[model samples]
Target: MTNPAIEAFVQEANDILETLEDQLLELEGSSDPAQVDAVFRALHTIKGSGSMFGFTRLSQFTHHFETAFDLIREGKLAIDGKLIDLSLKARDTMRRFVDLGGDNAEADQLSEAAEVKNLVAALQSLTNVTSAPETTEEGASQAGAASEIAVFDIWFKPAADDLRNGLRPDLLLGELEDLGDVTHRLDLTAVPSLEKLEPLQCYAAWAVTLTGATTEEAIKDVFIFADDSELEITKHEPPVAASEPELTTKTVAADKGKSNKTTAPIRVDSGRLDEVMDRLGELVIAQARLNQVTTRLADPMLEAVTEDIERLLTGLRDTTLSIRMMPIETVFGKFRRVVRDLSAELNKDIKLVTKGGETEIDKNVIDKLSEPLVHMIRNAIDHGVETREGRIEANKPEHGTVILSANQEGGEVLISLEDDGRGLNTEAIRARAIERGLLDANATPTEQELHQFIFAPGFSTAKELTSISGRGVGMDAVKTTVDSLRGNFKVHSQPGQGTKVTLHLPVSLAIIDGMLVRLGSDVFVIPLSAVQECVELDTLETNRESGRSMLRIRETLVPFLDLVDVFNYPESKDTRRRVVIVRAGNAPLGLIVDDILGQNQTVIKALSVYHRDVEGFAGATILGDGTVALIIDTAIMIRRALQQAKAQEAPSKYVAAGGH
Candidate 1:
């Protein structure tokens, strides 16, 4: 079994490393003191925690990286592009050590690897480069940082119960000694008789005399994270006269975490949270069942009790969901490195601008969101953005811009990756589609229809392939992931303007507010996020002769599909029918159903493998009466309409998503 401390350290270390990369990137532009301090604190915390948790190799590697920041803190060195590059590379090395579960032979081998040796040598050289002539006042301070001149006395004793909490006094002392010259003696006076002693308890203390160019606060920082420990430091003044008694400065350590009035976050494994969410979903279903029973009983007291349970369930559900809601910025932060590295590799002046990062979404959705976004970003950089000279010739800025923005709608989150570059060449795309036999030669499709072919399998407009993209798999993968999430993807581009790809996704996949509708005796669900409104099907406006149909509501025409025909269910015999207006690919899609049942909270369940490939349905859910109702996939319905049009070579003003 892994020690809880080690587990916590690993989680915290990964989080720090993620933030550290962004911080390093920020230094390239700002390099402000506050940012520098943040980077330093992150490294210090990781080094201290790694050592405490037996990640000795990781701690050792981070110490060299930390030393560079220490120079920056003291104004000895400066933050430059070269130093940031080294820091980033060294940061990767530290992450590798952490991932190795350090202190093992593999980590030891990595510690002596060629790459590790070179990185350390480079950092040491950077430190040496800061050492100017000792004649200059600034250089003198840097030169004597490690030289023995100033003197200090230090004492430390661990809290009796701290060893059980993964305290390592020896490692702490070793880290301090690295700062300067030291002579130390161990004190075992606290040890009791052999019969009375507790083996698990720590009964050791240390007293040390140090001579170095270090300050009292610097020495005190060695025990920074060892809260509630007996630590004292006294700095001895240099002798002014031969007979004068030496005066010293005495200071005691204070608790660090409590100095800030914020409580430390408790890290629970994601799996545990998922389990809790699963249980909560079941409770919601049971509550629905209870509500149904009370309505059937028509008892005042039972209905009142059911109301209380319903109110309580609502609060619990909201609280549970809020815990799972993480900011999209966590993922957004990773893309800075992506943009930076890509800029270097492509030799293009490109900028990434992000907005609305504070928008929140489900962790599961965010987890699957990164890969597709990366593919799109890569596509935008490689294929969407033009070269600097080409952009200049086009009367555009020399540098290209990719704007990644996210915002939450009523029940959906809209994430868009838009680029101000040479927009999609619709004519070229149309030509390729015709050549590939993907479109009817005589049929004229809209610009949006031509753009859809950009995401088709094995589709590429590049004359020659590069390592970045052009295999045509990038956009195809994006579409696949989006479809699986039951999300909508729409592309809007102007010939000279740019292309913006917007993904409309639900805020949560586990549970959603769904509109219940019926087709004959069978019931189905349409995600409320997709539904715009419902209106009466005023007329039987069928166009089978042209293999197309439309529904006119007020003054607008929408492509409409009958659920009965789509699902092969019995047609409704009612005198009136209704159409649910759903947003699809910049236009409204209408779904004709027998009748509308009221909306309800839907707990989504993945379909069994045997039924997973069934079209027109996203997932299955248990209705209030305990029967399974398949959720209608609005995105799929739109795509199905698109495909049906192509099969018939129908000419229309709009096209749906599956293939454009």
Candidate 2:
């Protein structure tokens, strides 16, 4: 049987392990006392709770892990690279134990594994603390020094069904005893008379006086996993002299003051957030329909009501999106560990500098972004960064630097990974491209064009495959993921300077502000963020014999694409043909359409598998008039048009050269 309590414990333990990693990594950069305490407390919590929830192996393993940090807390050990590395490995072992979900056979095997033995021995060696038998009660009391002992009055009352649900009060009390000298009394006043008592009901409570050099936080950690229980802890000052045994209550105002400052946030499943967003998208589509109907009615009160609805919906949408928005720091924090590990393994001195971590992105985007970012970071370390010796010869610092930054740019979020190393070798990339038949040997391509070849499947400059990379799948996967998010990326490099790749993604995928346009009885939606302005396609200017489809907007010549020809739609005879000027990167493109249909709040629906392969259309959405319209991927269309233009110019240039 799957015990719900055990399941919850596993989930919480995993979360703690993640946090433990971050704390350990942070501790490496600075020997912050608070960070050290946090790490110790996390390990202690895992050990205490793991035993109660049947994670015997995990609990036993963490006990040893906690002892190392305990020594650090007591000034018996110092933070160093060796200790941090062992802690990381020990943390991973604990994670594996938790992953076993208390399967005794597997847990036993893992507990006896050589790796676990090595990790424990390594951890013990650091503290010079032998593996000795000790009870939880003894451990808790010995956790803090008697010289600095503080007394705490702790009252705990478990829920009526807590015992049935696997609450181990005995183990909890033992853990408390482990913290210090303890005087605990069971309050049985609520227990029913034996004749009328229900055997399964919990009718007891506890009041305990604990004197130790432990903080209130330590006491709370004892009850961390028992959310259903009522716990109150008050700290009292230690006796001034051994002869004067009587102690007075010390308010410890600072700790008490922090309790009332903020409300606790509830843990919510991300699946529920996704459901809310899906429903919100549907509500938006319905509101668009109502707005369209109200426009036709032209009644003053109805129009006012429609306007109010729109405003309310807009506010609700913003609020919902904000709820799903998480600071990008959550993702950025993990990379510190990655960089540290990679630097050690690769034997290179590389520093990771992050900025703008407070920038927010939708949770969904953040979840999918981690893997791609990991690949890019690895690529930067393994390929882009030069060896320390190479760096010295290049007149650079011995250590290479990788900068990971995030910020909001208009309606999109821009995340960039830049490395100050030997930038991409354009000549080498060009040669590889020609050898791979990705480019013509005789053709001259721009640096950017040559860089694009790196994203092709199975494209790599590595002479041999290493465990880190060289399979040539990392960059290709990055491109695929960014494209799936309806985002685009750009690469820039200066040969001996560095390389920077920036990704541009929408703030939200559920709803978008789109411009509606029509072409030969079909309606389409263009992302409004990309659209600059709409202008009439002058026939006289377009008919010139230059054999180029270009539009002169003001003084700049921008490439233009006819939607009818691009999509193979029947030609429209509408003389009122208009062109929508949209910017893609630094270049602008004009899209020719039949007519303008104003703006819309489009609830974007992802394309079905059947139509997903279609090049230009990003997705489909139902219009207010009950018609389905395809959403144009402005970035894709602009790229396609530019490619076509380049192809056309290529042939003409070749012919001119042949004539010469």
Candidate 3:
């Protein structure tokens, strides 16, 4: 079995490193003491805890870095560009050590590598101070005169089952020995007789007394990961002249009302959460079946029980989904380094400003967002943001700004990345589209339509290739990912101002509230988030005379698509057909269906390989009658209608010109 404590360290180290990057990037602009102190504390925790957990190499490597920050904390050193750059590099090295799981063959080799050696040397040069050697029993006695010595009384007893969970008290004791002059005695009062002994159980405990210039906090950290054990630390203050000895005793419990972890969150593996969601999806399907049975039986008691179950399931679903939801800031926090590095590499001054980071989305969606957002950021810098001199000439600030913002709108999350720089070159995009045979030469497409050509496969208007863009694959991949998530994107640009790309994505991909509609023999689900309103269709006003299918809701003439024609089904003979108006981008389109079924919770499942490539259907879900209903992708269906309309208009326009 994997060691839970080590796994916890890995997770924590990842978070610390991410925050470290953001902190270091901020340090470049401001030298706030609190920020510096925060950085120092983080490094000290990693170093101290790293040592206690068998990461000797990582601990040793981080000592030099910790020393540098210690000097900066003491006003012995100052922050500069060189220090920041090297510190960032050192932080990267620390991440590598953590990723390698510390104190292994790879980590051993990394410690001896030239880059690490050089990084350590550069950090050492910052303060010209080498780390004090590890405190030894004899060394502690000699150093006692130099600093006020602290005496600690430590006692710990591992839980009887801790050994089975991979807790090694010996390692914890050895780590404490490195802190100061340590002496200990074993307590075996709990040890059972040979006849009753359990081989894997821990019965012995330790009482250790240490004299060192270290706080009780440092000693407690030796057993930090052993949260299930019992631990106590007492400090003995030195006696004043002619005074009796005094002591301040603090009882620090490991698992029982532990001082440190009272408010700490319980970290769970996301894979387990996904598994719960899958089981919940099945429960939803079974609930649908139950609802169907109760409806047929028409029994009052069964109906009452069914209603209670429905109410409880709704609560369970909302609770489970909220557990999976995380703030978008988790992804947004990563790009500070990206922008900083890109600015330095491109010799441009660009600042990244983010807003609405508190908006939350499902974990699964956020996991896939980082890469596409990175690509978008890269393009914003490489193609959108102008050079410093160019900005000066354009009467703009020397520094370019890229703003990434996200917000929840109804049932969808809108994430937008916008930059202030010379915007899209429409003429260049249009020219490239025609050259690539993606657009007709004689066609007059809107600027918006022309701008979308950037996402076309193997499409670029760049004069030359750079390592970043001109490969023509980044935006295409982004569009593919967005579409796979059942989302759509829009691009808006002003020639002299900037370009903004906005992605509209569903808040949760696993389950959603949906409106059901029937098309011939098929029942289809439309995401309730996109559905505006439903109306009874009046077949008498077909508007076939105008050579178009349209509906006038109030006064607006909204185009409508007949499912009988769109899906090639037999014409619906029902005179009471309904039109479901759904929002698509900025326009509203009407979908004509044979009947309007009520709404229900939908569990979305990915399509099988055979139907995966097919358009218009997002996925399939089980209905109350145990039948499969195809979920309509509203945005895609509307876009398809627009494409078909455009295709028809092309033939009519050519015929109007009297073309044979």
Candidate 4:
């Protein structure tokens, strides 16, 4: 089995690398001292932890990388484009080494790779060239002088669960020993009796006295990753006078005030969170069944008890979901590196501006959104944004801009990518659709309809293929992913202005507020957020003589769909039916059902692969009565209804032209 300590090191190293990239990119804009220190500290922690966990190759490589940042920290080296570029490249190389699990033959080969050699050479050259003769002499003079050797009284107590989490206190103490002369003592007063002792729990503490020429910063670096540990350090100065021979001691409590005043949030494994959510879903289903039982019994006390349980369950469900919600900014931070690299490759000046990043969504949704968002940003930079010369010719700013923004709209989150570049070419797209046989040559499609052709598989307007996007697959993949998330996207563009694609998705996929409806003996659910109103279906107005499926609601022409016909279910025998009017985009769609079964809080379960391809159904859920009901994808149904109306109208239009 793989060592858990090594695994933890690898995971932490990956996290540090990600943070380093963000800091490095920020350094490019402004070289803030705090950011520089953060970069150095991250590298130091990686190197220190890598050494303890058998990542020798990674440790050594980061040692050199850390040295370069150390110079920046000490004001010996200046932050420049060349240094930042080298740092970013070196960061990527370090990531590869970390991936190799340290000290492997492949890592050795990578260490000797040409790119690695060049980066090291470049870094060494910077330090050599920037080191002035006087500065070197001054550093030599300081080293030659008798450095003050101070004694530090150190105490460390690891948390009970620290060892189980893969913390190696011995390795940590060894690291401290390398810093200076040390005498150590172990305190086992907290250890439990043999019968009660837990092998994995850490109950021992340590006290040590270290005499060293090292600074306090160097000593603290040893425990940088052990934030949960209780640690204290006291500095004891050497005797002020030989005659008196008395040392002065000053005690410094490590984060004592902060620890006492604040509570730190615990880091939880996502898998555990998922398990809790699954159990909560089962409880919700059971509670719903209890409600059904109580209502049937019609006992006052039982009904009151069931009502209280329902309210408690509702609150519990909301709290569980909130635990899985994370702000979108976590995904936004990585895009800066993308835009920077793309701009360099394409030789175009572009900027990415993001807003509403604090808006939160389900973690699962955010995880799946990264790739689609990357593809969209790449498309915007490669195709949407005009080149520098082209922008100048159009009297626009030389630097094009892409704006990524998100916000919450009721039960859904709306994420939009807008680019100020050459927008969709409607005429060109229309012609391309005809050439690709996606549309009739004589067909005249509206701008919105024509714009959709960009999402068609293998559709492209580019004359030649490039590394970026000529082989048109990006937007189509975006659509597929959004659909899988039960979300819908809209494309709006104006030639010479810009293009904006907005995605509307539910806040969570686990549960939703649904309006249950009956179709024959089967039941279906419509997301309550999409429902506008319910009205009685008029059979006379919907008869064959009218040749129309439109319902006029308060001066608006709203199209309606029979759920039975849409799902191809058997007809119902019920004489009365209701129409649930829902707003889809700017249009209102009426869904005709046999009866309205009232509102329900549904725990959504995704459809199996076999039924996933079936349109007009988002997923399935179990009702309070233990019956299965399919959740309606109202957006898809509305689109289908409109398409059917268009198909029927086309034949009539052709006949009218023939008569004319």
The whole-model lDDT of each prediction reads 0.83, 0.83, 0.83, 0.82
Error of 2 at 187 (Å): 1.2
| Candidate 2 lDDT by residue in tens digits, 530-643 | 889888886425532245577676766778889999989887899778999887555578899999999998888888988888998889888887889999988788777756
What are the TM-scores, per candidate, against the unseen true structure? 0.89, 0.88, 0.88, 0.88
lDDT of 4 by residue, 326-402 (tens): 99998998898899899989999998899999999998899889889998999899989999999999999999999
Please give, for residues 407-441, the per-residue lDDT of candidate 1 as tens digits: 99887899999999788988778777777767656
* Candidate 2 accuracy as lDDT: 0.83
What value does the lDDT take at residue 582 in candidate 1?
A: 89
Q: Any runs in candidate 4 off by more than 4 Å, and if so which?
A: 129-165, 168-213, 236-263, 539-548, 570-573, 651-660
Candidate 2: worst-modelled 10 consecutive residues by lDDT:
651-660
Clashing pairs in 4: none
Cand. 3 TM to true fold = 0.88
> In candidate 3, what are the lDDT values of residues 260-362, reduced to their tens digit?
5666678888999999999999999999999989999999999999999999998999999999999999999899999999999999999999999999999
The 10 consecutive residues of candidate 4 with the worst lDDT sum are 651-660
